[model samples]
Target: MRANEGRESAIRAYTRYETLTGHVWRCACRARMLESEQRTGLVVYVDVSNRLQPPLPSGYFGNAAIGVTATSCAGDVVSKPVGYAASIVRRAIDMVTDEYVWSYIEHLKNQEDLSKFQDVVACGNPNIAVASWMRLPMYGIDFGWGKEVFAGPGSMSIDGDSVILSSSTGDGSLIVAICLEAIHMDSFKKHFYGGII
Candidate 1:
């Protein structure tokens, strides 16, 4: 696993050698299932009850494996593969993806010969106003609990691993709510409650 900015990161890429025939759906599902199994298995195998951050990208691939030699249920323990299966899988995926990416880059660089250009606009950002608040009234409907005490807009966007939520009152009073994935949700909840977790 590679550490980025003092945080561990694992990037996993899986390639199935079987679908050269171009059956897209099966191939895609297989890859997705493989990734899901890896993620779920490793999370429990490591007993990382309190750990967070999606297992870093480098260690992600170490999770691929065939057969259910073991089982993990909630907090229950079960047999696990020998050695760092998750880590090993992760490395293999990264190596393969890196090779592919580099090969493609090299091929493009040789053909397009655009390496001389310093500033290239990949795509111009189209100005789009995201109105998530328009969906706010829908939330109360989901819970089947009738309308909320107040219907207002929540201003927030996900920034990397963090989520910034803007809370506004009917009177236009505003507050910021910072959130992170599962583990950090509690902290954000506390902040959201503002003294009532």
Candidate 2:
């Protein structure tokens, strides 16, 4: 049992390593796209949940997710190492404290024209949005029968977006689903899987 526990711990650490590396790789891909597509600043939004150190009840089902934006110039993101982009992502996420959450709430409440907030982020202009569902019990979800054999997001157009889904094997691995324009998909795939930079 102790050995199994140790193995699981190591696998979890490796999963985290992969996730960070994947994120940086995605950032680099976006930067390359910006240069190819003649776009400007890169605005990356990462979904951050406040449930880690919840200020509310543990079982509260209300939405506790916030989108944290990390902005950088195209040249900076492309020229820097993966660790640099990872650091920017880490800092953006770490800034979401309880106080920051409350402030965001207040800011939303004070909005005069909430319709402006409803506008979806444009896919152009070097934007990337990433949402991770890795920790969710996706495979365990069952309507009445036993655990599901497989589960994942339905097919959708994800141009300029990415989703991290839990692997179906119950192992500490993640399935990153990315969507890109047909023109840029080849380059993105090269950087993503090949670690070209």
Candidate 3:
């Protein structure tokens, strides 16, 4: 039909269709496909830099307590078994340790300190901060009712792999969200939602 379509058709006929992620596949035409492009699985981590009123103490606010909001890329949040999702959120929060946060904060503080001293001689920043491994899981966001409007596992940051999720308003609600890279997202969805035959 169109020039690009004709080229794509030729590629499809000759090029192999490799399993890229989950239900998502990739043709030889494209070497790589990012998760954001395919809308398969995503993890977003946003540092809520907004200071709360009354200046919360570091220890009190450091608790991984937050809200969660699950929405499709279309921005319509599905309403079904939200409480179940809430539990998953709580589990994610309970899993993280305070030491990790403190270590990160201290590391950043050191960076700031180094920046201020203009003529500091070089003895490499010997600050070795080790944060234990943390895993973000997304195998539980299942909506058997008429297929979720827009279903996504979760997203997070690269350094900490922090599963960033919006705050949810409900009892026993947790604000943590487990985000995955595009690769993990596809695999996880298949285990939960099955393959697209």
Candidate 4:
């Protein structure tokens, strides 16, 4: 934690994902130079495997996650410390449970067009959609030939789209990758990983 007032001095605990996403959200919003009052959303994918009544079997290989958003104004992101965004992210994730999952499914069922479902959290500037694969067993995946050079959620086509993946070497490090506009890339790079041009 670099020196930034006494924001992080409080006795508070945050998961690695929460902390990173919170920081990234602040950076992304700052990079985009969004208005102070504009709504900014940090979309997160929450895993609902264990939240189910009967957990999915280990062999039940498939996506079991739901996308949630932790949103605040651009000013809030820039003004508040990392803990603010982290707390928002943590709250968003914690709000998802079995009932929430079921309600989400019902909402999906009621939707006339599923394509527009992501319009709320996933959009252009001031918004980011983060997908995390850190919990998945990815490093050991072999498609019958050999170890993969990289395993992730594929390329991020839109600005503010990002992915969090475990290191391929199984070294217990994370790869936090994001896609931003060319104009904003430098600023985002500076804020995301400082001291780098």
Where does candidate 1 stray beyond 4 Å?
Answer: 1-94, 97-101, 107-184, 187-197
Which candidate comes out best when scored by lDDT? 4
Model 3 agreement with the true structure over 1-197: per-residue lDDT tens digits: 01122234444322111111101111100112222323211121222222333335665644333221222221111121222222322333333344544564576577936655554222111100111112233234566664344323333344212222222232422232323345454443443233222
- Residue 27 in model 2: shift from native, Å? 5.8
Of 1 and 4, the candidate ahead on lDDT is 4
The candidate, 2 or 4, that scores higher on lDDT is: 4
**lDDT by residue for model 1 over 71-138, one digit each (tens)?**
12211111222122323323333333334444644766687566654443211111001111211322
Steric collisions counted per model: 12, 0, 17, 0
Pairwise lDDT winner, candidates 1 and 2: 2
Q: What order do you get sorting by lDDT, best first? A: 4, 2, 3, 1
User: How much is 7 displaced in model 1, in angstroms?
Assistant: 25
Which is the better candidate, 2 or 3, if ranked by TM-score?
A: 2
The residue-level lDDT of candidate 1 at 159 comes to 19
Number of the predicted model whose TM-score against the real structure is largest: 4
On TM-score, the stronger of 1 and 3 is 3
Candidate 3 minimal-lDDT segment of 10 residues: 15-24
- Per-candidate TM-scores read 0.17, 0.73, 0.21, 0.84
- Model 4 Cα lDDT, one tens digit per residue, 1-197: 32233555565577878878888888888888889999998889998998887877878878898988888888988888787888899899999989999999998999899988566547568789877878778777679988788678776778889988888766788888888899998898788776212
Q: What does the lDDT read for residue 180 in candidate 1?
A: 26
Q: In candidate 2, what residue range of length 10 has the lowest lDDT sum?
A: 1-10
